[model samples]
Target: MYKSLRTFSFLFGYLPVAAMNLKKFQAQKANLSKQEYDALIHTEPQKWAKGIMARTKSRVETSGLDYLPDGPALLVANHEGNFDIPVLLSEIPKPFGFISKKEVKKLPVIPVYMEDMNCVFLDRTDRKSAYKSIADTVGKLKDGHSILIFPEGTRSKGEGVTDFKSGFIRIAKDAGVPIVPIAIHGTSEIMEKNSNQIRPGHVTIRVLEPFSAEEIEKLDAKELIEKVKTTIETEVQSMAQRKADLQ
Candidate 1:
């Protein structure tokens, strides 16, 4: 209970002030390229997220960053916990946005930051809006900003990865970009599994090699999705087993 309260207090206390500063920065740098603007806006939020993870005593280890190429690409990962976003933002060297649920756009302070990062919001219940969101994401990718998508559509709560929703493949294909598969393990153990209370834990994020546009085009959509899904799941299960062995 104390940890939850502390986490909430820290987030609520810091965000509004941070949002104000970001808005000033945005207005002053209105002419910056989208990528430049996003990197600038995300600087503080990334720092804040890393601080929060530290406060919770969570350790994040990332691998295979060298495999991420320059320019635009689609980052697809399994959904495991609420901490996944922060962990990625804090650790991943690239400055990128995400495909977030539309409801997140309604949250205080956060929406501003996401917008600054060029994030696309999807309302799954509304097919029209969802499709529009996907189009917007593709445009961003083509514009040279990397984007992250969970593909699982929702968190698995550490039960193990769920089957991915294949629609995001359209973004990569449409943008003529590569898809980088990422597998994240042990995130839910930090907070989601125990009623959202923050705690000490270790998280692993592994970035697999990119599937180039040429490579994606060689496979049918089903084959492509299955290939990426299998790659991520294989790594996730291996990481989970390693965590269990340490325990």
Candidate 2:
């Protein structure tokens, strides 16, 4: 309870203050050099994410980072919980954005920062909006920015990983980028499993081998989806078993 309260205070207090600074930073975007702007836009999220993880006393460990492609690639990850994003941001040594639900766009000043980071807002209920979001994500990928997507469309909030939707496959094919599969386990224990109360948890992330554009183009939509899903699912199960064995 104490940890949860402290984490909430950080979110509620620190974010608002950061927003004021974000506005001033954006206003000066035209004058600042690209390096200066990029550093802040990317590092700030990592800082906030690490802060959140620290406040909760969570431990995150990642492996297989060498599997990452040399250039921009679609980061496909299964959504495990609310802390999943923070865990990735803090652990993955990459500068990228993610596909966020439209509801997050309503949050105060957070959306402004999300936009700066090239995050896409997805409206799942609105077909047209969802399609537009896909296009936008592809555009960003083509522009040399990596983008992460939770293909499950919603959090499993448990040990199970739901089937991935096929829409993200289109984005990967259209952008002609490699598909990097990521398997994340144990994040939900931080919040979702505790009924939204923050708690210390161990999160393990594994980056599976990436499929090149040539390989992705060879498979049918269904085949690609299942392949990526199976790869991630297998890793998730492996991580789960290892944790259980330790316990």
Candidate 3:
């Protein structure tokens, strides 16, 4: 209970401070272009994400970063917990944003940062809006900003990965970019599995080799989705087994 409260306090306290920083940034940089402003402001959230992991006594070990090619690419990963986004934001070497739910746009300070990061908001219930969001994401990708999508659409919360929704595949295909599969394990143990109480844990992020645009084009959409899904699921299971062995 105490740990949960501590985590809650930290999260709530950080918001107002983040909002103040955003205000200051906007006030002092009136002439900056949109891209320039986004690039400058993005560092704050990256730093904050790292700080959150550190404060919670969590360790994230990553591998296969070399597989991420230069230039804009689609990063597809399974959703595990709230920490999944933070972990990726802190660890991914390139500057990128996410395809988040449209409801996030209604949030206070967070929406400001997300918008600055060039995140696409999907309205799941609105097919037309979701398609528009994907088109917008493709535009962002073509503009050289990487985007991460949890193709699983929702968090498994440590129940193992669910079937991925294939709609996001269109972004990479339309943008003529590679699709990089990422596998994450152990994040749920930190604050999710134990009822949102922050705790010490080890998480692993594995970046699988990417499928080039040509490769993606050669495969049917369903095959491409299954390939990525299988790749991540295999790695996740391996990581989970390794963690278990360590214990």
Clashing pairs in 3: none
- Residue-wise C-alpha lDDT for candidate 2, range 33-146, written one tens digit per residue: 654565568777888888889999988889999998776889999999998899999888777789988899778878888998889998889999998999999999998888
- Please give me the total number of clashing residue pairs in predicted model 2: 0
What would the per-residue lDDT of candidate 3 be over residues 65-159, giving only the tens digit for each residue?
A: 99988877899999999899889988986678898888887767898888768799888999999889989999999988888999988889888
CA lDDT, every prediction? Answer: 0.87, 0.89, 0.86
User: What C-alpha lDDT, on a 0 to 100 scale, does residue 29 get in candidate 1?
Assistant: 81
lDDT of model 2 at residue 82? 91
Query: TM-score per candidate, in order?
Result: 0.95, 0.93, 0.90
Best by TM-score: 1
State the number of backbone clashes in model 3: 0
Instruction: Please identify which of the two predictions, 1 or 2, would achieve the higher lDDT against the true structure.
Output: 2
Q: What are the clashing pairs of model 2?
A: none
Candidate 3 global CA lDDT score: 0.86
Candidate 2: stretches off by over 4 Å: 20-39
Query: If ranked by lDDT, best first, what sequence of candidates would result?
Result: 2, 1, 3
Better of 2 and 3 by TM-score: 2
